[model samples]
Target: MKEKAEKNKLLIGIILVLCIVILGGVIYFMKQKDQNPDSAFKPDLDSNAAAMEQGDGEDEPDGIRIPGYPSITIDADTTDVKMNLMNPEGNPCYFTFEIILSDTNETIYTSKMVEPGKAITNVTLKHGLEAGEYPAVIRITTASLEDGSAMNGANVETTLVVQQQ
Candidate 1:
């Protein structure tokens, strides 16, 4: 009877230790998952209209095309800015335009994905700026048409002229 009681206690102790180790492992994995939530999430390339607009031909350039931006002017009191954000034809990727203020590194405007041979004519700024000439950058981010993965991009430095109307 005494030997049987000792064996039962030993079995219970082993089981409890295994349960604790498994619980610790679960907690560790949960924390790791929280650290990198979007590691596995990939944006669908097909959903972007730009990806579908890619033209197939041997004439298309093998390399990415980076577009340039001229200095932009806008009214001080209004957030509406007239600009043309374009993705050149024969390019193989999509373009995303981001207009950032140079002094504060603040992004005033971000355009939707512009497909090849398409353009966004107007954009609403995040906020109106004071009447002054501000140095700015037009940061272009290119994404692959095949997989929506990020590709080589460009930053075109320009001036943002905010004038009182």
Candidate 2:
């Protein structure tokens, strides 16, 4: 009886230690990821912005994320821009990304607290277009978290042709 009790106590001690180690590891990783959010960004999907079409320019991030380089299509007259996005995780209670038309530094889209497992799509752009060629500078900004605790951010840029409408 005494031996069995000692063995059970030892097993419990080992289990407790293991749990602590696992919890600590999780905390450490979370902190590291938070400190370097850009590192976690995945540029797997392609961006469907207007600039992508018509062989336009792209934003070059110093250390950020951008989906594979893909072009977008443009038509004459009125221009329509589309922006598609995927939420990174399911727990992003409130995450935000900013889309800017660089030419005028105008914010075309601002998504807030996008739900995870859901895809954000079909954001249209609005601006007067001329017959001449123009650089539709674009900028996309995303952060690591939503609780103001996030510091690292990622940005992407691209340009599009504005045909005279």
Candidate 3:
């Protein structure tokens, strides 16, 4: 009877240790995830007033409206790209645009958080590319308007055309 009691206590001790280790691991991972910068989109609370003034003329849609960009043009000598990156007034969330080079999987440009009814007309690339056409992706990361939390997003494939200045 004494031996059985000792064995039961030992089993309980092992179970408690396992539970503690599992709980600690879960907590460690949760903290790591929260600390990761790319884990979620952090939104800019202030809306772009200038962009709001330059509205995209269209009736409000039923759902989130993701503007399409089939191509973008830029001057080879300069980093300024002529494109309208907008989040229509109809949308209920914020938008962050990332222009990534397809060939090298490099992000050339990342826009600030854009609110609904606003647009980003002028954008400067990270670096100037040579005069040529390059395949790229416009990765749109959306965030919740109410809480500024990460939300659904979209990727629009486009051709980045660099013209000789």
Each candidate: what lDDT?
A: 0.79, 0.49, 0.83
**What is the C-alpha lDDT profile of model 2 across 1-165, one tens digit per residue?**
999999999999999999999999999999998889686544333243212121134443343334421333344455354445544333332235565655677775565534333445664545434544433333334444344344334454554444433
Candidate 3: where is the Cα deviation over 4 Å? 1-42, 45-49, 52-59
lDDT tens readout by residue for model 3, 1-165? 999999999999999999999999999999999888877655663343235564457667676788899998888867876778888786888889899999999998888788887787778888889999999999999888866877779999999888898
Which 10 successive residues of model 1 have the least lDDT summed?
43-52
lDDT of 1 by residue, 51-162 (tens): 2244565476678877676788888978877776778787778788889999999998887677777776667889988899999999989887756788899999999888
CA error at residue 26 for candidate 2, angstroms: 34
Best by lDDT: 3
Q: What TM-score, computed on C-alpha atoms, does each candidate reach?
A: 0.63, 0.39, 0.67
Could you give the candidate ranking by TM-score, starting with the highest?
3, 1, 2
Which pairs of residues have clashing backbones in candidate 2? 52-71, 52-72, 53-72, 59-157, 95-113, 130-164, 131-164
